[model samples]
Target: MDNTKLNDSDPYSIRGSHPILRGQWITLEFSIIIKTYYTDSTKVEYRDLENQRIQNIQGLEDILNSEEIQDSEKINVFTNRLATLKNRLDVLEDLLKTFYLDTSFLDHVKKVRKEIVNEKG
Candidate 1:
């Protein structure tokens, strides 16, 4: 998606003409993938990923709030951040695919579950 063509006035500019279902589906998939990192060891990695996402969001906010940068420059920065986010999302999708393809992922899940049960018992 070319952010240059985005209409700043249009509320749907970010997702373009895509339906609400597209956003919802992304959210659902992201949520499911995040849940896979529930184990204590993986939680740190998840937090790091999450922090990077938040930093990108903050970068957008900073760009928006800056008075010195021209609107055109802001749009360019926004476009870069958007691309970064999209790339990260693609990475998550790839991870999800790997999770499904490799049975070893189940072993990690089982180990986490055993740890939880041990703590509870």
Candidate 2:
């Protein structure tokens, strides 16, 4: 579907003494498609944050489960870190519902990812 067509309001707009059947058809079709993948922009950000937290927890868990680690205190530390990360993820998920979807936020994320890749090179 064309982005322009998705963004058009004329076909979806209701303004006439007699209802436009074509316009209603267009609007109904558009609404169905839009609703299927329509996550609030804030939810997307929250998802990213959640994924990051899960990655961190997995890393910590791997370290804790390693046979090379003989120190019980060190394992405890890793467990604590994972718990803290889970808490942070919960907070982000809660805030996701309140976030506005903005292009700039996504651009910033992309730039940060690029920087990380560059630094690793």
lDDT of all predictions: 0.52, 0.48
- How far is 24's C-alpha from truth in model 2 (Å)? 32
Give candidate 1 regions above 4 Å deviation: 1-45, 48-51, 55-70, 101-121
- Which candidate should be chosen as best, given TM-score against the real structure? 2
Question: Against the hidden true structure, what lDDT does model 1 obtain?
Answer: 0.52
Clashes of each: 0, 0
Could you tell me how far off, in angstroms, the CA of residue 106 lies in candidate 2 after the best superposition?
16
Q: Which residue pairs in candidate 2 have backbone atoms (N, alpha carbon, C) closer than 3 angstroms, thus clashing?
A: none
Q: What is candidate 1's lDDT per residue for 1-121, written digit by digit as tens?
A: 7564574335554454555544654544554554544422233233336654323333454565577667786678786875675466457755555535445764665576467557635
Model 2: per-residue Cα lDDT over 6-121, one tens digit each: 54545544442235544555444433322221322122222235553233444666687779778888888787886886575445433432342444644554465456347534
Model 2: how far is 34 from its true place, Å?
22
| Candidate 2 clash figure, as a count | 0
